[model samples]
Target: MEFRCIQDCSQCCIEREYYPSKKFGKIGVLILPEEKERIEQLAKINGLKISILPRIGISEEENSNPTKILAYQLMGIEPNGNTCPFLDTETSDKSPHGGFPCKIYNKRPLACMTYPLIESEPITLD
Candidate 1:
């Protein structure tokens, strides 16, 4: 299915309607060490808050293979879960085709760069 971005469809960035103009958005992306500095700095400039995923490498369940635990930074959550802080929640003239434009579109992470396109990809649930 060809996923087209519809106008006025803030479904992806309207998860937090209570506080429409939030600065610290919780993303579901797992950032890498190499991307930490860049993403953090940019996110800060855009008024977005970053959170560390798996904050710790050592957990109760994964005590055997500690390496499995990863420390990645994220901006938003599982697609519709959290509204991206970079997104212009205040839908107005700036919003295009009804969707909010990313404040850092050019520097968006790999997860967002390959959005919807991967939506159709097969999911392996082991």
Candidate 2:
């Protein structure tokens, strides 16, 4: 079987969930460390306000701040953390698949490119 996005459905881009727990709040689009700077630049170029937080990190010592961050999350725009900041909600333009267009579609992060397929036990869908 093949997997494809539903036409006129932007559910994946429009909704976020609290990962690990609610205390961490709704997790945003996963952005790899290498993509962080570019994402920030894109946001700046588009005149968008964004919040990026560390999603995964590693440290040389225990209980110490991460010396290197592995991943970051591009937070949503609403208070409940729904809707991607780059979803182009202001415009009426739709994506080729009939969903809201991504402002940075061609330059989207790797995580966004590989959605519904995550590296975990048994390689489950997210």
Candidate 3:
């Protein structure tokens, strides 16, 4: 199956929620291996005090709960079924001149980067 990633579509945010990152909890954003200082600097500039929690995922144990997983695919729910705070439906401004913006674009997780390319080769993988 060929999966063409979403074109500027943040649909994953539809079902992906975030939490206080285990390590970057105080920065309001999760920190990737190389994004620490950049994210920290950005947070400082924006005055955001949030942590970067690991993005949650559905597991085999939860396979029986299609509703739960479906929620993840449709609502970005937390393990406890809470909606993601970063999701803003009214902000899509994908203009040709550069207006569409994600509030957390820089701090977005690997999952966000790997969208639509789910089975790509490791080299192409996010």
Candidate 4:
């Protein structure tokens, strides 16, 4: 079997969901530690305001503040946490699939590149 994004569908980029639990609020596109600065720069160059939060971190001790961040998340623009800031919603231009194109598609995070393919009890596309 093969997987492909449905034409005219940008649900993956436009919709957000609470993960681990709602207490943590809606999760965003995962950005690796190495990609953090670059992602921030992309936002800045595009003149877009973005919110980034630590998604995973590591520390020497348990329950202690992380000394190093493993990954970060690029939050959405909506108050309810929908629509990635890099998604070109301002223009009528569309991706090859007919969905709204990502402003930073070429430089999108690895998570975005591997999206819909998640690891779980039984690995599957979301």
**Top TM-score hit:** 4
Mind giving the per-residue lDDT tens digits that candidate 4 earns over 1-126? 566755335666775567767766678888888898999999999999999999888999998999999888889887666788988887787767678877777788887776677654545678
Query: After best superposition, candidate 1 residue 56: deviation in angstroms?
Result: 10
For candidate 4, the C-alpha RMSD (Å) to the true structure equals: 4.1
* Candidate 3 residue-wise lDDT, 1-126, digit = tens: 666644345454443323345332111222354554555466566555534443333566655533222111122224443333344445656635433344566565555555544443436546
- Candidate 1 vs candidate 4: which has greater TM-score? 4
Q: Worst ten-residue run, lDDT, model 2?
A: 1-10
lDDT of 2 by residue, 14-116 (tens): 6555766676567798988889999999999999999999989999999999999988888888876778888887777776766887788778777666665
Using all chains and alpha carbons, the TM-scores for the candidates as numbered come to: 0.55, 0.78, 0.37, 0.79
RMSD of each: 7.3, 4.0, 11.9, 4.1
Native-structure RMSD, model 3: 11.9
Q: Rate the local accuracy (lDDT) of all candidates.
A: 0.56, 0.78, 0.43, 0.79
Worst 10 residues of 1 by lDDT: 12-21
Q: Name the regions of candidate 4 deviating beyond 4 angstroms.
A: 5-9, 20-24, 95-98, 120-126
Ranking by lDDT: 4, 2, 1, 3
- Pick the winner on lDDT between candidates 1 and 3: 1
Number of backbone collisions per candidate: 8, 0, 12, 0
What's the C-alpha lDDT at position 38 in model 1?
84
Instruction: Single out the weakest 10-residue window by summed lDDT for candidate 4.
Output: 1-10
The TM-score that candidate 2 achieves is 0.78
